[model samples]
Each structure stands twice: as structure tokens, then as C-alpha cells.
Target: MRRTELFFPRYAWRQPGATRGDERFRRASSLLCSLLLLLLSACSSISPKETAVSKTGESTFKSEPPKKVQAFATPERLKALDTQEAFEYRLGPGDMIGILVWRRPELSQEGILVSPDGFLTVPRIGNIQVLGLSVAEVKALVTSKLEFFYIEPEVTIRVQEFHNNKAFVLGRVSKPGVINFPGKGTLLEALALAGGIPDQNKDTSLTKCAIIRGNDTIIWIDLEDLLRNGNMALNAPVRNNDVIYIPESSDEMVYVLGEVQTPGAIQIRSGMTVLKAVMLAGGLNKNANAEKVFVVRQQTLKGDVIRVDLKKLLESGDFTQNFSLMANDIVYVSPGGMTKFNYAIEKIMPSLQMLNLGFSDLESLGVMERLRSKIWGQSGFINSSSSGATSTTTTTSP
Candidate 1:
């Protein structure tokens, strides 16, 4: 019998009819492979993102993923973005316009407010529509009209006050409300005016800022790239009524219901997994069918229900069944495998009815307070710090 060995790194193949040495090599290789597999299992079990968000069941809400403006964009796209950055301020209703005729101060007027009808009541030009017109365009119009009264009338027009041309900035910022752009508001400018995004301590890669134009277009920009990396290419021009939403961790939420100790809404943070969410909901109850856990994600009218075996994930460290949760996702653990979705909803309805009848738990109470705060501003607990102590004062919200 001849002794032969084939080897490359951890891999090995045994030739048939070989000697004892070859047999020993085969045994060693098999052990190495087993160890390698165990190592992989250990690494996967310890992975930080072991819990992770995923796909659909239910009515179809057609969701187009947010369009990301890449930080390292092409020169052509950057050029296009640059063109919108230096736009002149447009005049609109309630905007105060100042007009000067160089030497003829008598003909000029200061603090002339544009009427709600978008017309500026100039002394001689009567009411000229300057709502959507830029300052230069309005000045040109005024200058041309004054030409009738003087030779090459030198007219200088400026916006004394900005009452219009507003952008709605909502979400996690120092000031989250309607931000007024003095003139030529860009995406960056709008954010700055709203006191910029607050310091986000979570994973920056997961943080995104969106610009909603009118009712159709949504422009998504990675806040990490724009703010941390100083990516100016993502800064697009903001139009009037454009809504910029930079959601905070508290702003986004997920629902954990059915068979949980304290089933309720949980704020979604970066890397929030199903396992993590379950633990936050005070772990599962004794009656929970951990093998039949369902994640219901609904967008618009369309959605999907994904089933995972939580027992496998938590007990055996089977990472395949555990997935991350997105905003507004519902994690439902059934009491039995044959549980119906409608029946679960019916069970939840009784609790809601009880709340309506002036009966509520701590979970429901906090949720109700948050809902009231959202519907009507300043309707929740207000924290005011005094010397040597912090106090929470509650305010009634209608």
C-alpha cells in the first residue's frame, strides 16, 4: 500500500486504497471542517446585526423605496444640483418689497406689502402681480413701468421682509415646524433655518432626510453623507411648500402585540430586530406560540406577513428566523398555530373599547398621551429641570 496526501489549506481529499498516513490526513481534515463550521456559527451568533427589516402581506400600498442621492455623485448630476443652489429669492404674497428710483426718493416706497392676491400696490404701477416673480424680474417690471415717466429710470427693488416662500420642516430638529426661507432656499438652507438636525447618536447610516415636493416627488438624502461627510451634491433647491422630514428615533415606531407581557408600540432605533423588540415588549407570555411568530408590514393598501420561528432564534441561536423591524411594522405572536388575524384584531378591539370607557393601563396611558401630543402640539409631559432636581409636569391636550 502506497501513502499519498492531497491538501490545500483546510481542505483535504482522501484517495481510496491508501495507507495509514492518508487515513490520518483524512481524519484531521474532517475535524478541521467541523471546527470551521462551529466558528462560523459562533461568529453569526455574535453578529451585531443578527436582528434586522424586511418584506410584505394584506392590502397593496405601492411603496417606492426612497431615492438616495449618492455622496460621490457624477459630475453631471453635481452640475445640475449646483445650478439650483444659487437661485434668486422669489416674491410672494405678504412679502414686503422696497423700491428706490435712485434720485427720485419721492417716487420710491418702503415697506410696501404684497396683497394676498399676489399684487404689489406700487405708487404709479398700481397693482402688479409679483407672486412667483423673482426680485430681479419684479425690479425689471418696475423699472420698465417707470421708464414711461423718466428716461432710463434706475430702479432698485429688494425684499424687505419674507412672509412667503416657506418650506415645511418636520421631524428631529432644534426647531421642527414651517421654516421660512428668506431667499433662494436650498435643502441645506432649509435645514439650517430649522436649527439643523439634532445630534443623532445612533447609526448614522440608518439616518435619512427626505424632501417631499408638492404631493408626488420624494427626494431622499443620507444625513450621514450630507452632514458628516459634507456632501453638497445632495443639496437640492427647495420649492415652496416642500416638506423636509428628518425623523428621530422617537418619531418612528413599531407595534408588538398578541401574547406579549406588555404588548404595545415601541420606538424603532437603529438595528432593531424582532428578538430585541420582543424583549422590549416585556418578553412573551406563557401562552405565546413562539414557533408561529408573524411580522405584518403594511404600506398603503398592500402589505406582507412574514412568519418566523422565534423559538429557534432565541433558544438555538438560529439567526435565519430573526429579522429587523421597520417603522409601523406589527409583530404578532399567536397563542396557537391556527390563530386567525381577524380574531387577534377582535381581541385588541376590546382593550381599545375599555380605554374609550375610561379604563386604561400604563401602556395604553403612555400611548394615549403620545397620540394626544401628536394630534395637538404640547399635550404631553413637559420636563423642566430645577436646581438639584428634574421634574415632569403633565399638560392637558385637547
Candidate 2:
């Protein structure tokens, strides 16, 4: 009987359990248990699927697809220049005035400067602060003052040089600087005086031009719309000390990395769309899945995310899908590999390797050609053989 029979007498014993047999059985049983323990230690641990998942599973970063760009259809607020509200011109310190005493030659004055305190001392009119008052108000005040002494007087007040209140024009305009408000001035007149904007001015784009007043007060004006539609309402007038700074259209760049024929930032002009940007990036590589083109646009208010399918737009010419690209947009074309690991490898590494290999092959071929030419002189093998054979024949005949 086996030695294990002695360890558990009833189970192993069809016969009697002797002392030696029992010892052998106990020894065999202990050895078997030790072997099993060692085997268990050497063997790979078998875990429940759930337990394995709990220990080492990771979540992947799947970016949200880009939403179709919606067309902004908000109606423009209409403005009428002719019947619009008359602007109120305010008086300030350091403004020059011309007070004409109509028909009264003795009292007529050509030039008069307002005092630092905003007061103007007129003849026969006790010192009065005309600051912050309109030209009409000043005329009325002077006329009232003259009533005390002279017969019915007619007075006319005119500003010699519009000062104190100023506006600035900068950027792509022919001339950019502080512009004085001659009267209630319109933006059109101001731009014209500044020599008109350059044809290449970025302000001509959809981003439009803006007017800034108090902090956080920005009024965006669509120059193209106003010019095309003749909307006088959008032609808001500039105020005193107002700055009109024009910015160059920023040369935006879109990165077209991963599985693209050319992976780099492309020059993005005004109104450039994703399809156009992709074309600039040299289009998709052979391995690229055209159906999986994505754009990563950074939003001012939201977190960064992957964007829409560009193929549909490109193929169908969907106006809505042709969204205007912002600065620094990243366009990624996916390589349709089955596994994530394969996808990354095909999209990111193999294509670069292929390009390198192609270059290396070209270089090697050039080197081989050079070496072969150096070893074999300018005359090829056939030419050399013929010449040698002729020389031998000539020598033998001679």
C-alpha cells in the first residue's frame, strides 16, 4: 500500500495500519501538501474578473465630438442717421472759442481761451463758467448779460479749435492718432479723416471692429455689414478722448497632427473654415480615416474638447459644418486601427518611421550610385571591353 494509506487509517486502510506504514503515510501526506503549496506560489495567481478589474482597470479619455457650428442669426439693431437723436456736445476746460457780436463791430472778438476753472470772462458780462454748457447755452448767457446795458443784442458762439475732448485711431488706418471732436462727430467721418483703413485691415473680417468706453463697455461694429447694407445705425459716433485702436488680423494657425500628410500649424486667414484649414495641412495621409477628422477648439467659457466630423462637411459642402476657425485650433485625423494601442501606433509612430525610411532609402541609393561610379570610371564596362579588345588586336597585328 502507498505510504499515504497509513496517515488516514480508515480511508487508506483496507488492511491494518502498522507503525511504519502510518509513519510513511504521514510523511507522504506532508510532502504532498508542501509540494502543492510550492506549486501554488510558483503558479500565476488566478483572480476573479471583477477583482482584477478593481485592481488595475483605468478609464480612457474619450473627448466629446465637436458640435456643428450654428449660424448666428441675431437681427441687427437698425439706426437712422438723419432722424437720430442729436448728440449733446459738452464744454470743458482749455477749449478755444470765437464769440461774434453780430452787427456790433466794437465788441467782436476773434479768439478767446477758456480759463483753467472753466470760466470765460467776457466784456460787460461778469465772470461766468461756461464749462459743460453747449455753444447755444453760451450764446444765450452772453445775450442775457448784454440785456443789462445794451439794446437787443444778437450773439453767436463758435469754437475755434475743438480741444479737451479727443479720440484715438490706431492700427491699419493710413494715419492713427488722437482725433479732436469738431462737433458731434460720426465714426465714418473720423475714419475718412484718418485716411481710411488699409484694404488688408483685419477689421474687415467677421471679428469686426470694436469701440470701448468705460471698463467692460465694448460695442462691436461690423464694418462690412454697415458698408454693404448702408446701416447708419451701426455707424456709431465716437466721443471725446475716445480711442479707436485697430488690430492687425492675427495670423491664426491650426495644428494638423497625427496621420496627416503634413502635420504642422497652417496659416489661418480671416473666415477660414475647417475644410480649408485641413487642405492647408496637406490633407489626410493614406492611412487616415477621412470620416474621423476632429477639431479641438478652445472655448472661452468651456473646457477644451475634441470636435466634429469634417468629412461630411467637405464632401457635402455643408455650410453649417464649415465653422469659422478660431486661433490655435487643432485638427486631428484618426487612423482607423482596431485597438487603441494600434491606433496610437499607426497614427503617431509608423507613419513617421515610413517617412524616415523613405528618406534613408533615397540617401542609400544615392551613395550606392556614387560608389559604383567611382569604382567604374566614366567609360562603362562595354566601352572599356571594346577598347581593350581593339588594342590587343592592333598590337598582335603590328
Candidate 3:
């Protein structure tokens, strides 16, 4: 057999006349070679190194290592931690104390008030200086004094009323006054005694709340962090005469007025827009003319007003008309045919005036409730019927 016959068994018939089997064998061999070449080309398209690098780069970009967050104490655990601090009640001036001696009725005294000089008068024991001394230390001192008259005298000291040590809580709290405690108290306890921050004033910054002690020392308590996030590290212990001030929040706020269900102030958060502010004010009322919305910015005394087409914004998906609102901005949705800029200002002037009044004045005049009712009345704006009401509203003219 020739070389071609050995390689392609039946395809060696080209010497004289090729048989049908010779052509079929040649076609099958060509087909098999084409398939092998295609397989080789496909395998060489991507190298092993390229595949490895692609996978490595994808994993590196797609996945990130988790961040490390510090552990914080839970509320229950923080309370338990406060209990671990050993606190002893110290005797001071104006503290009513009682001295009891076992089996010595004549020597015992009740209702003994400590004088301003921090001295307590006893029947046999002369004035003893008990100032700044704990109850246990005072008991030891009294026992030592009685040792001269009797053998092994057992003395017990009790504090009937604590009046010398006090902590003051002021600003934004429900009750801003002095709080008297017998022993050492924590900042949390002082706030609780002062009735905590009022619901209306929930925007008070706990991080800014200060604990002022003496003339030089001031400690800041992060009550908000502690209460919200269980961060007890800043929960400092309050001292006598310490002033805990919970300052009102200085965060920017936007007001939504006019034809809204609940026209009031809403905090300015990130990405807040006119539409969001209107929704926060309980959405537009039934008579609200969505096409005639106005945004009044009171950055200065004169203020600037911009007209917004809220109907187009919501129905036509025109986001460009839904402007971003700034702090102290007023979003007023007016009634139909009341599109004048001055009319919108007239609607919002009363609210702006009320904001300027102090909390005390507003409380005394019952202005908050009256203002709400007046805004929601049939007129749907400031009442023009009464001359006094008109004069008062005009005084706060923009």
C-alpha cells in the first residue's frame, strides 16, 4: 500500500480512477480536521492568565470588606453599669439628720438640722463638724465622742431630708427647674427628674446638652446618642449645683402652609424637595390649586417668592418644576384664582409671626391653638373680619 493509502485507508484510488469510498473517506477526514482546528482556536481565544486576572479583578471590585463598628452598651447594660459606681451621701448644711444610740434613749436626738456652719448640736457631744463627711464617717465620729462617757457605744446616723445638694435642668425640657437628690446622680437621672425633653421640642440636640459644674469645669452629655444608639460612654455623672442644659435644635426647617391639611413646620432633611415638603404637611387640601404653588424663601427680611407648577410636576413628571427647598423656606399651595405673590405672603405671615414669639408668650396667649384654628377656618387664611386681628397680622408684615 502507498503512503496515502496507509494514512487515509480507502482514499488512495487517484492512481487510475478513484472509487466512491475513496471520495467519502477524503470528505470525512477533511470534516474531522476542520472541527479539530475550530476547537483549538476557541481554546486559545482566552489564556489561563487572562481568565485568572479577570476573575480576580471582578471579585476585588464587586466585594468590599465589612467595616469595623465599635460595640456599645445596651440600655439595660448601661443602667447596670451606673449601679456599679459606689455613691455615698455626704452631710452638708441644711440637711436634717437623726442620731440614734442603741440602749441610750436620752443620748439619741431626732430632727437635728445641720447648721450653716456644718455643725450639729448634741446633748452631751458638743457641736461636731459633719460637713462634707459621709453618713458612715459621721457615725464613727459620734461614736468616738461618746466613748469618753460610755463603753462600746453603738451610734447610727440617718439623713431625714436632703436640701443642700441640687442639680438644675434647663432649656427644652418639660420641667426646667432644680432637682434635689440625696446622693450622687447621673445625667440621665437628672434629665428624668426634669421630665425629659418635651414632645414638641424633640428636636433638641442631646449631643449639645451641657453639664456645667463649678466655674471652670463643663461636661457635655450625649443623651441622644445614649438613648438612640446605646452609646453610654458619654453618660457622665452629674455633680451638685451642676446645670444640665438641653439646647433646642438649630436644624433648618421648612414650613408648608395654605391649602394643606396640616400646615406646619417640617425638618429639612437631605434631598428634601417642594413635593416632599407638601406631602409632609399632610398633602394638598381639596381646594388646593396644584398649578398655583409658591415657594417663599425668608433668608432675609424682605424674602423672595417663586411660583411652581405642581400639577405639571406630578402629572407630567416634570421634575425640573419640583424645586429643592432650603431651610426656612415656605411652600404655600394656594386656592384657585389666588395666584398673587402677595396673597401667598399674607397667608404665611401669621405663622412666621408666631414663630418669632417666645414660648412663654405663646403659652400665655394660647396662640398655638388659635393660630391653627384661624388658618384652618372658612376664610382659609388670616381673618380679616376683626380690626385687632388685622392689625396684629399686619405688624409682622413681610
Question: Between the candidate structures 1 and 3, which one is better when assessed by lDDT?
Answer: 1
Where is the poorest 10-residue window by lDDT in model 2?
Answer: 389-398
> Residue by residue across 1-398, what tens digits does model 3's lDDT show?
66554444443334458766445445545554565575455446454655356644555435333322224334454454344357777778889999999999999999999999899997699899998898889999999999999999999889899977788999878889999975677777887889986776444333447777789855555555777777666577776677988766556678898999999988875457899889888998777899989999764556789999999988889989788776668899888664466566886676555444433343333333333343343212233244544322322222
Error of 2 at 313 (Å): 3.5
* Candidate 1: stretches off by over 4 Å: 1-86, 170-176, 186-192, 195-210, 215-236, 245-267, 283-321, 327-398
Q: What TM-score number comes out for model 1?
A: 0.49
Q: How high is the CA lDDT of each candidate model?
A: 0.71, 0.64, 0.71
User: lDDT of model 1 at residue 375?
Assistant: 43
Using lDDT as the measure, the top candidate is 1
Instruction: State the lDDT at 189 in candidate 1.
Output: 94
Instruction: Give lDDT tens digits, candidate 2, residues 1-398.
Output: 65543334343223454455344444454454565575456446678665233344564634565444323212343242124377777677778888788788776776688887899878767678998898889999899998887889988898886676667777768888877766776678778878887775443343456566556645566665666668676777677666666556545466777777788877666567777777777877767777777777765435465555766766786657666677677878888665467655766575466545543443333432222333333311211253445211111111
**Model 1 per-residue lDDT tens digits across residues 1-398:** 12332222222245566655445544544554565575455445344654333444443545665323224343355456444645666777888888888888788899999988899888877888888898889988998888888899888887889877899999777898887876667878988899976655553224577777766766667665666678777677777888988766566788999999999998886568899889989998877899989998875456789998998887888998689777778999888654566566776676556443432332223433443444454454433355746455567544
Candidates' TM-scores?
A: 0.49, 0.57, 0.43
Q: Where does candidate 2 stray beyond 4 Å? A: 1-84, 92-95, 102-106, 115-117, 148-153, 163-166, 181-183, 200-206, 227-233, 300-307, 314-319, 338-398
Best prediction by TM-score:
2
lDDT of 1 at 56: 41
